[model samples]
Target: MSELVAAEDVLLFVNAAVTATGQREFRSSAEEQRFSLGFLHEYVRVNYRPVYAAALALDVNHHNAALIVEGLLRTAGEAGGAEEKRAEGRLIAARLAMLPPQRVYRLFRALRAAGVNNRRTRAIVRGWLAARPDPALDAVKYRTGVKAAVRHVHGRPADPETGDFLFAPGRRVRYGNALLDAYRRAHYEQSAVYELPFTVAEGFAAKHGVPRAVFLERIAPRMTRLERLRTERASGAGAELAVMPLTRLALYVLALPFGERVGRRAELTGALRASARRAAGPYAGSWGRVTAVLDDSFSSSGSAVKRRRPLAVALGCHFLLEALAAPGAYTALWTSGGDDPLMVRPYGPTPLGTRILDALETEPERLVIVSDGWDNAPPGLAGEVLRVWRSRLDPGRGTSVVHLNPVYDADGFDVRRLAASVPTAGMRDAEDLAALVEIAQFAEGRTGFTELRAYLDRRVEHFLTEAGA
Candidate 1:
């Protein structure tokens, strides 16, 4: 056989090992072991060398190496490689099964640190103890370790059973919190990439029993959403849901009566007002004046006035939840945002409006007011108001307004394409606002789908370049 093994070949071998189907024994001969290790080292260099190095440093055995590799993959590349993690757990179980009782304790310590405390995993550990039946001492030893770890102030439980440690009843562990803290640190710093994937996998797998490949194929997208939600929740974004000031324009228009067709007008107007009422509770007493505008429009007789209500009603629902949940956290309705055509709110005004006026006056040069050219206002009305609002923003405070246009919503009305045809500077439509918000986010250091595409583009180019090189 040729001495040189390609990176792809080494990857195939490693992949097989992870799935528990490869040659269990390393090459018996010294020369073959050398070639194998060399191939393994190169494979990791291109893929996960950093993780392998860390795990290998702790224990140079094949089992630990496999765990660390998959862990790093899940963390760095997969985000939630549940299937791979489950496979790794099984390998750990198998290794523990072969070891003596004392050796099994060490395995438990490592596995626990990785976040694998499931019953199936625990059973494997128990099997080792069964061989040496220390019934009287086993519970005591396990309980003591658990209590000490939990009481250490640093310990946080990896599992949901908070305040209770993994090994014993009443002996709580705080390892979970510590692990999360460590995860944040390592992920931000990129120093401990391997451990997190391993840790997260073990933690999730212990609870969910997801196989590694299935995790990649199935759970990753769902996990990404949950992860994003968790991030927003931790940041206090969820509780802060409130209406945007700009959206009040739509609410004002919705309350008015329009066209001669009086059939669904009353029903539509009622639905719009109810949504507004439900939203009013969040801002204390801020809802009173906004709702009055809607009620007065019904008493008016002008057809021109009534013509604006449909757009107003449609835009009113969009404005309330999103403006309150501004800068992000926008969804149509909690249930609807999760489904169909997939609605997501674009980013909104920068530095926030509550602080915008004061901040602009104090530190004028630092202020940036970003808006999408579109809001759900009638074209002429939306344009005039935005300009008037911009004037009030205090140019003397050194504030600069960036009015982004060509807003889009895969689901919204097309103000952007219309704007391209007309390029009018006046009031923008709902489509304009949607596109502007998306663009503003992209402009303001937040990565969007386009940014991700750009990243993938660069990576692809680099790969092709390296292959040619």
Candidate 2:
């Protein structure tokens, strides 16, 4: 493939991997997402193998990262491939180190089921398990997964009790490991269940008919930050909402009853802005004369599974951009024309073309458009406006414009673009906005595939060092 075509192809796959989670979206079904993603995965793996392998370091979502690991191991494309097997192996190990334990275990199960028992695969699996700080606790909490992983890897557990707990349960009258002992006791005694991790205790709680409120209350001290944040809404206490990631916090704020949100506007909005400032970090107030055309249109309602995810991403970006702009140099225009971020909700057709026109009139030094790129208010108005502005109105390149799409359009094989002139990068969280802004230059046709590959190489090196892998 030509360098330009190759550059675009890698970008298309990167965008899909970053934003698509094989879940239902406002404008697409889950099956549609899967079929589209499957095709992209295979196509990139065969054509741009090295870059495809390099994506592991670029913060690809858990779903895609797991798939990448599986594909790499199944093919076992050692030394003779475009990227050496050793290098790819390091990427796989680093990515697995970053992935959730559940996903990594699931991936191991899949590899075993597929009959992929290569030496490298076994070593990778062994190394990951060796790195866990508390494998004994893992034996208790993730019993089935750890069991499968160990069985698939065909090794005895380091602790005899841990091995017996999986292969020969209740073989010992009392296990040496405290957590292992708790697992055996929780099977018979109600109070022993409380000693286990919250996730492990949940099943015992249900079996013993304990009320959810009581279980949650008792489990609060043992719960992780994210766990408490997740259950806080249901349990009615315990999470500092501000501690949540900006996108998640925005989604939570949007999920609250409108009346509750209005009544608690100061607290919620203040929390969002503070979180935004933290995410902005050293880059805070760095963008000069910035304007964000954020989409809060009805289509942004996302899907039931994703519930307001698109809108949440936009809301998060709005606050982050507000934090990133020079003092009094930022402006945000929601497509629905709402002035209050707190009051913004999904409604009306997406009038992106009009919003683009309005943003352009202000002549911002940087224009960041966060949208799904539907542009249906007047059919292609957004694209036309952008095309004209890029070619005619801003031929001298006076203003910088970049599109950050929160939704990936399956049929397009990429995040749908408002215009070829405005570089569009898929974004799942606004926290990634600053990094993606620099990454988007490759999509702007200013660089070729070689430079893009170089960029991925740098990311891989840094990712390995930072992960201390």
Candidate 3:
């Protein structure tokens, strides 16, 4: 689990490093360098392809990039079948194509040193050498190649002009006068995939004079319930509510506009309880006393644009745990004031300590707290209260406390200031609540690098199987 977490962290770091705007101060260059070196060592030892791309992109350490290329060559040599070799070649080509000329030359040197004289490798090297030094042209060619590869893989039709498939909806054509023509066609026809970015979709909708109902019908199905609700609220298209799906009622209700919420409050609570009951049905006999403290503070509302995401995630966790617990063994406590129908409405400040104390009265064997890890009310008291409770009341009972954070901290730490003993797990999606046991294990240091690697390997195998390669 820690390894998976580390891999994710490394990926995030790579993304930041590759696209870092010099102004941001998330981490110092020294810290990033040190961490990148350590990560490269581990990743290269395992022949991880992502790390190779990142290492090459970093460009600051030529030696590290060379090491990555050597690792890739070694892995390629170890591959058994023709298909495996082809896959390895494609991966290497893709990575190399993305790098700058200097880094590509460095990679070529490493490949030559490693005696990697494959036809595909030679072809990639020749292509790079033949390409002009113009960055714009090089980028276009690279994207065209990528689109062609995607088309081949997905068996999609290729574009007549570029001989490339349109994998992304908002992709612009570079042929003479074709870009504007394609945009116009896309606007009127909605031929592009609905998975296009919100801004692009919004622009297209506005340009085409698409009605709110049409936009909701065509695009909302592709979006998550929360996303659709946000779009509706932002566009002042509340009337499109009739067309919106109620599959994720709890999340939908949490994300609804303030005015529209009054009428749906009762319906939302009922839906939440029903969903919880369905999820908990399987573990009917195994449930013990459980207390869940959900943070519904202002921070959980997220930004004005992506409102109620954290609250939705919290509600997801809340309902899942509620269903799992025995009828008389569960207690739900929200950070803000709410009684029977607990609406995950983020408005006030975080009073986590008080909520924890209130939940402790139930004497639950397990305590799960879902928040963004930004506790402010009676600041930093939650950790103290947990310590005092454990020390004074039930030291021998071994009560478990798990802190699940939905928001990623820019500072690189999980929680602000929680007890060291309390494990913190990231909640990237609402579905993550289903893995509560695994998450708890991760928090408690029981799930380690080996388990994480095994899980990742399994996923890779599954992908290959699904791809029929």
Candidate 2 residue 359 C-alpha distance from true site, Å: 1.2
- What local lDDT does model 1 show for residue 94? 43
TM-score of model number 3: 0.56
lDDT of 3 by residue, 7-96 (tens): 544434332232222221212344443454445455544555443433343322233444455566655555556775665555445445
Candidate 2 stretches with Cα past 4 Å from truth are 78-83
TM-score of each: 0.20, 0.97, 0.56
Better of 1 and 2 by lDDT: 2
Evaluate residue 272 in candidate 1 and report its C-alpha lDDT on the 0 to 100 scale: 39
Task: Give Cα-based local distance difference scores for all models.
Answer: 0.33, 0.89, 0.56
Clashing residue pairs found in predicted model 2? none
Q: Superposing every Cα of model 2 onto the true structure, what RMSD results? A: 1.6
User: Which candidate ranks first by TM-score, i.e. highest?
Assistant: 2
Worst 10 residues of 2 by lDDT: 75-84
Could you tell me the lDDT of residue 300 within candidate 2? 91
Model 3 residue runs over 4 Å out of place are: 1-251, 274-285, 340-342, 415-417, 446-469
